[model samples]
Target: MTSTSARPRLAAGQTTDKDIASFLAHTEPVDALAQDGYLAGHDGRAIAQQLRRPGLVRALTFSVCHSARPDTDRFYQDDEEEAAQWRRRRTQTIRDHCAVCPVRAACAELALRDEDVHGVRGGLPEEKLALRLATDADRLGKARAADDRVERLRSVRLDAEREVHRVALMHTGGSVPAAKRAENNDEVRTAVQERDAAKKAHRTENGWTVAA
Candidate 1:
């Protein structure tokens, strides 16, 4: 069982002076930015300096502090079942903090744009954010990478089907003998089965709706 007490706690109200001070004292701003994949090609010291500005600090999602569970990194790296337990414990803490947070929308938007970012943000987990990212790609004006992946898989399946057909034809005798035809049919059946399985797997991975 997961212990909810391990989650971060936040006091009610606006971004207080105490909140800002506690966040800076307990958390490393640059590390949080780096985890969001926003630190590349940027100097850590410079980012940290910018984060110290009161306005920027107040606007930051992590500035709420309590939304950031200390075990976030560990949570993402653990086995699925263990990670799920951690997520359940952390869920209410995130919800409580985000309910009054000033930057919840911005935080959710950022989470949507970054696929590699893990852990909870704006009351949503990384997995939920990933699904939103995929489903909302067109709405967000991003390229549909999932569509591209499906196209690639379709191509692969077609190639496999073609190869099976080629093998069947290659084994056909001059008179199209029964034994040869039987062998060809078996090979073709196996190939079609393999192709269907691959297509099903691709659809599942990309969350494509299965056709009737």
Candidate 2:
């Protein structure tokens, strides 16, 4: 995101022909932006004004914001359950906002191009965007085949880990602390060990040489 201070701030409801022209010059492709109802309720003039204002443009076009929310926390979460809850809430919030946004298509394209983007953008969380890019790249015969393979393995690993957790909870009467202690319990321990083994095997199959 670029600084808005480079251009003079516009007064409330104030827009000049020059500002509109500048916005037009920097505008993304209209046809692409218009697809998928991105511009459903917006007209040319309103969109031009939004584009001219850098601050407003970023706010409306991007998912991350200064406002406090479950999504505002950095992605390096220490708690898996909390992280999953936050991601679900954040994803829904972003999707709802993108539903009527005028620049959603542009946002989505940028997100696909930058797979490392943090936070949600264009209604997709970082992982989802990576999957989308990998899928698209595969369709286009791009060099993202490895990424696609890794992502698939990652998904399997996640599912296996969840299943382990489920088994652990079931063995521990649904108490997380009890579940942790259940590592000595054959059922819970077996589930965890199996998940770990499967994850290691999948990574090895993908040519990952590092120790798990």
Candidate 3:
């Protein structure tokens, strides 16, 4: 806050005085993020104020910047434990304030757009928001990464299987046919089998009887 005070404040715009002065006088490239499909949705103007106010949003972002995973769980994890209990109590206050707020989407858009912003954006703040963001971002990242890896590995496995099928077709009149070989190379079938194998192993290792 003290650090940010020197940054340029928003000039009164053509709209009402109540509208938030921009958080950044000029929206820097670093400050802008992929908000097209990212924000969870909320009122823009009202939410923007919460973002502009420096306390909870700033505290949570700072915590995430220092965190190992750059995620919201850092808020609850308590490295900011100097005032951990106080911080948790403070979260409720932020929530109460946000509850009265009419601009939750604006807050969410600001958070999503600014990579620097983390944790809960609107009605929630700090660890409450952080935990959800971490879960969502982690799940999305993991799934996308897994999909890429699966695609690459699928090509490798399919090429190998094709070679075997080709060799069989050449050696035996009908040992392995082109149709079965073609079906095995499919993305859905291979991915499903791969997922199943991984799940089975995970379940066994975790001592679970059901497949994940």
RMSD to true structure for each model, in Å:
19.8, 21.1, 17.5
Specify the poorest-scoring 10-residue window by lDDT in model 1.
40-49
> Model 2: runs farther than 4 Å from truth?
1-81, 138-212
- Clashing residue pairs in candidate 3, if any? 41-105, 42-105, 43-105, 47-103, 72-130, 119-129, 119-130, 120-129
Report the number of backbone clashes for model 2: 0
Candidate 3 structure quality by residue, lDDT tens digits, 1-212? 12344444456563543333223211311123112211123334333332322222432332223232333343343555667675775566555444444334445434543433454555555555455456557543543454355445545556655655554444334565777666655644556565556555433332222211
C-alpha lDDT (0 to 100) for residue 118 of candidate 2: 66
For each candidate in turn, the TM-score is 0.32, 0.31, 0.24
What TM-score does structure 3 among the candidates reach?
0.24
Shift in Å, residue 116, candidate 3: 3.1
Per-residue CA lDDT of candidate 1, range 40-133, in tens? Answer: 2223222332232222333453444445544435334455657568766667566556545544444555455444447766556777778877
Runs with alpha carbons beyond 4 Å of true place in candidate 1: 1-58, 61-63, 66-84, 142-212
Candidate 3: where are CA atoms >4 Å away? 1-85, 118-120, 138-212
